[model samples]
Each structure stands twice: as C-alpha cells, then as structure tokens.
Target: MHDNLIVIDGLQYSNWNRAIFEQLKSGGVTMVHVTIVYHEQIRETLLRIGQWNRLFELHHDLIMPVKSTADIYLAKKLGKVGIMFGAQNCSAIEDDIAMIEIMRELNLMIMQLTYNNQSLLACGCYEAVDSGVTRFGRQVIKEMNRVGMIVDMSHSGERSTLDAIEISQRPIVISHANPSSFHAAKRNKSDEVLKALGESGGLLGFSLYPFHLKNGPDCTLDEFCDMVANTADLMGIDHIGIGTDLCQEQPISILQWMRNGRWSKEMDYGEGSKSDADWPKPLSWFKDSRDFPNITQGLQARGFHDEEVAKIMGLNWLNFLDQGLQAQKV
Candidate 1:
C-alpha cells in the first residue's frame, strides 16, 4: 500500500485510545467515520460528542476532527488520523427535523434511519413488515440534505432503503453492510438494494463484520476480495468502498447495548448464535487498523488496477464525503 493514498474507513466504532490511534496512523488511515451513537437520545448523544472532544484533546498528536475534505488533506499533511462523527441510528435527533441541522453543526455527518428495529423515521431489516420511510423520515431527509448530513441506511429495511434513495435529492449511503447474496444475515443488504443504490449514485461500504461475511470468522481474504469484485460488477466500481464495521476491543456487554438498547428486557444475540454472546473472530488478514495493508495486497492479488484499488481503499469515500458533507446549492 502506498503511504500517499488517502485510506479511510467509512465506518468504525472502537474502544478508542492512543494505541488504536497510533495503529491507524501506522496503517496509513487518513480518515475514519466514527460511530457516535446508536440508541442514545439527544442529551446522551451530546455527551458522546463531549467524550470525543476529550479524546481529541487527550490524543491531539495522533488524531484530529475532520469537518471537511480540507481536514482530510490536513490530516495527511500532519500525519494524524482524521476522525468524523456519525450515528448508526436517528435517535440522536429524536423526532425533531430541526435537530438534523443542529447535529450537522456539531459535525455529525452521517445518520441511519433505523438500527435493526422500527424507528420513527423508517423500518429496520429485522422487522417482518417494512413500512418504508415515514412522513417524518421524508422531512428529516430533506433537512439532512439541506444541512449536508448524510442519510445512511445500512440497518434499514429494503423498502425504506429504496425509498430513501428515491426521495433524497442528494445521494445517500449504506455505510457498513455486505451483499445478502454473499451472506444472508439480516444486516446484509440485497442485490436489488445495491442496484438501486448504485443507480442513484450512492455508495455502499462493504462490511467486515463476521456475520455479514460468507463464512463468518473463517472467511478467507480471497473470498472477501472476490465478493468485492463481484459486487463491483453488480454496482459500479465507484460506488463501493471499505466500511470494516470494526468494533475493536469492545466488551461483550457493549454488544448487548447495540442489539437490545432499552427496547428489550430480554437479551438479543443479533447475528451471533443464540448461545454465543462474544465478538466473532476477525479475519486473520485484516484484524485491526494496523492490518489495512493486507486488504490492499488482497485487492492487488485479485487483479485490481492500482487506481481502482486506490479508489476502493479510500479515494472514493473522500469524494463521497466531499459531496455529502457540503450543503446543497440552491
């Protein structure tokens, strides 16, 4: 992997600290969209941002906030990792369309309408019936578009996902998920959705989450790379990138929070087996921020041209963010 290539992870939520920051630097990761909230409401979401502020101060040398494409370049120039905020669910905005602008001002650039369950905005993939985007979701999407906040549907149901792509004037995204043809996990998207996403000029960031991979933790680099290649043939090469969904160093209890939150008293296993409550093992080739070069090498071995590999590794995401984070012109 060339150190000059702008490597960006489209989505990640790690137990961040100096060690992870250093690993990201060593891996040549210029920018990352970090998940700021899943189920937290407005106040708790603000607290999460406050915690990130503290992290920025504490790790000033290794990481910095990314508010624009200019900041991505600045991170490269200064040899620091650029961090951008995102929410995996719309709970942070909590039924208010105005809050979309507020969150954007605070630099929450991407938000999913649902997170494995029905929400005020849309239906999640886990729902038996997908009611699609609600009237409120349409209003929120417009507000998000105007404010330059991205509508991400990685966890949304198919109808809702398609509806978002059609209704939003600007392109939306699926920041982290795999094709259902590769793996049938509820979190994985379908070919129909991928086709609609590409046709609408949106992007899909392939997930490295175990449940979404073809064979869970045992999936080979070849299998993963081949899947990317196949998906590119289905979608356009420009519409695909890496969103590893890396939940590094998080405890098993955190998984409970992600899957259940406050909605259920009973435990939810999510994609894991009912008895398995632990994080599935990551692929041997790409386990952490430091292992990113392995993916570049895998792409190269799979015969991707240097330019195509570069785009998949990061440049495409940079372009997407550049467009998605800027307020719409009148």
Candidate 2:
C-alpha cells in the first residue's frame, strides 16, 4: 500500500549512484538523512557532497535538497525524496567550529559527535575509556545548536551522549542506534541513555543492523519491527523512527578500509592492529534501499495501526526536524 506519508530515513551510507536513487524513489522515501563522513576521509566527504548536489540538480524530479523541515514538506508535496546531508564524524569539521555553519549552509542537517573512536568533540562507543564530551565538543554542540544542525549521538559513548543531551538547547537525535537491553554490543545505547533521550524531547531511530538485533545476523524483518516497536512502546511512539544504517551498495574496499580503522585520523593503519573480525557480519536481508517496503509491511503484519506505522516509518523524524528547524528560527 502506497501511503502518502512524510517518510524520512535517519541515516543511510550506501554508495550513492543512479541505482540507489531509483531504489529510494521506488521505496517512497520522502526524505533521507545520509551520512557523508565516517572516520576521516575529508576529501571523500567533499566529493560525496558534490555528487549529491549534482544528483539534486540532474534528477530534480526524483530528489531535492532538504535544509529545513519546510524543504521536506515541499519535497513530500512534489513527490520527491529530500536529501538531508549529515556527517557521522566530527573529523569533517577538522577541529574547526566555523565549518559547522559552512556545512549547514550546504544542507548538512545532522552531525554525529564522533564515528566509532575518539575525536576532538567526543569519544565513541568503541573507545576503551569513555571520555565524555570534551571542551571542544561543548563548543561544537553550542555552534550546532546556534546554527540549527541536528546533534546526532548514534556512535557516541554513553557519557558523551548524556553530556550532549544535557548541553544542547535543541533536542538531539540518536539517529541510528539499538538498545543495549536487547543486544549488549558496544554500539547499542543503554536503557538509561534511551530514557534520557526521551526526557530531553529527542528522537531515537532504531537501527536495523543485524548485530544490534536479538537474532544477530539471522534477524528477519519481523524481528527488526519488534525491536523498533518495543523501543517505541518504551520510549513513546512520538520519539521513535527508522534510521536503517544500510550500507548495502558500498564498495567492499570501503568496508575493508573502515574495518581496519584506516578511516580514522588518530589510528595508524600499520601500527594499529586490524580488527576486521570484530566488525558485525552484514545481514542477508539488507540487500538494498528497495527493501524498505518490507519493513513497512512487516510493521503492518505486526498489528500496528496506520498512524502508528506512519509515525515509526517517518512522521516521528519529520516532527523532530520541525522542532530543530523551529529552534533555528528562534
């Protein structure tokens, strides 16, 4: 069933090409918050932003750039998927707070404090010592709030996430995260963090990565929906949404590079031992962006009403964006 819903994806890192765009269109995605940074590929990040801009210009009918909630509403009206640029790592800012506004003007709507390791702003979940949000991180959060970019805490450590939530004037988002209660992975957020997020009026996009699910690599769409529904039931449906961290079409070389932590500026590829085995095995169900429909259908089969399903799919994100954009105006 084609629902005329304001569907928004919290995070996607696929290899952006015509094929993926077509698939997104087929899936009825109204807007997508796509991460442009991971670890420290500054050059690659710039190139990807240009590519997305070109896509917006070339495929104007299929996609548009989203800088605010109003843009998303316009895209929905026009039946186009709005591309909301986000950075998964502060490394893109390269220790410069001024770049935050520059990137925001370029339509980078959301930014995670760190990727999966320590940075100038915050420590990631995988760090051996959780250092929390640094002084520079406080500056970053203030600038982000001032400039109207959504503060994302998906891969940030527990301490860092809490600090961000406390300091941010605008509501932060765990753009893509799973509950530690279900999966004890370092990448998953603790129940305490989830509660704080809800209390802070932020949103949590339940991730669909297999390792974060109860069934791990063997998880089905049903399992994914149950996890999200459970999170919604606990955190309040208004604060839950979809942030499928899908990397289906990414090059295997990129995956290998990320696994080695070569993408981080702090880690030396040769000196630091590889940790490819620790990386989660990609799920069989995550074939491409087109599989988004399966998630919607699965939620329907699980007995969610149309309004609840719509909220889980995208309305929740739309509402969160509206709050952030409104904060920007104030």
Best by TM-score: 1
lDDT values for all models: 0.93, 0.80
State the lDDT of candidate 1 residue by residue for 220-291, as single tens digits: 999999999999999999999999999999998888899999999888888776877789988888789898
Separate clash counts for every candidate: 0, 0
RMSD of each: 0.8, 3.1
Looking at model 1, how many pairs of residues clash? 0
Q: Which pairs of residues collide in model 1?
A: none
List candidate 1 stretches off by more than 4 Å.
none
lDDT of 2 by residue, 1-330 (tens): 545767788988877777788888888898888877776545676787888778778888788888788898898888888888888887778868888888787777788898777878989877789878999999989989988888999888899999999999889999988898878877899988998898889999988776567777788777777777778777888899988887756665666565445644554332123554343566666656677777788889998898998988898899888878543555
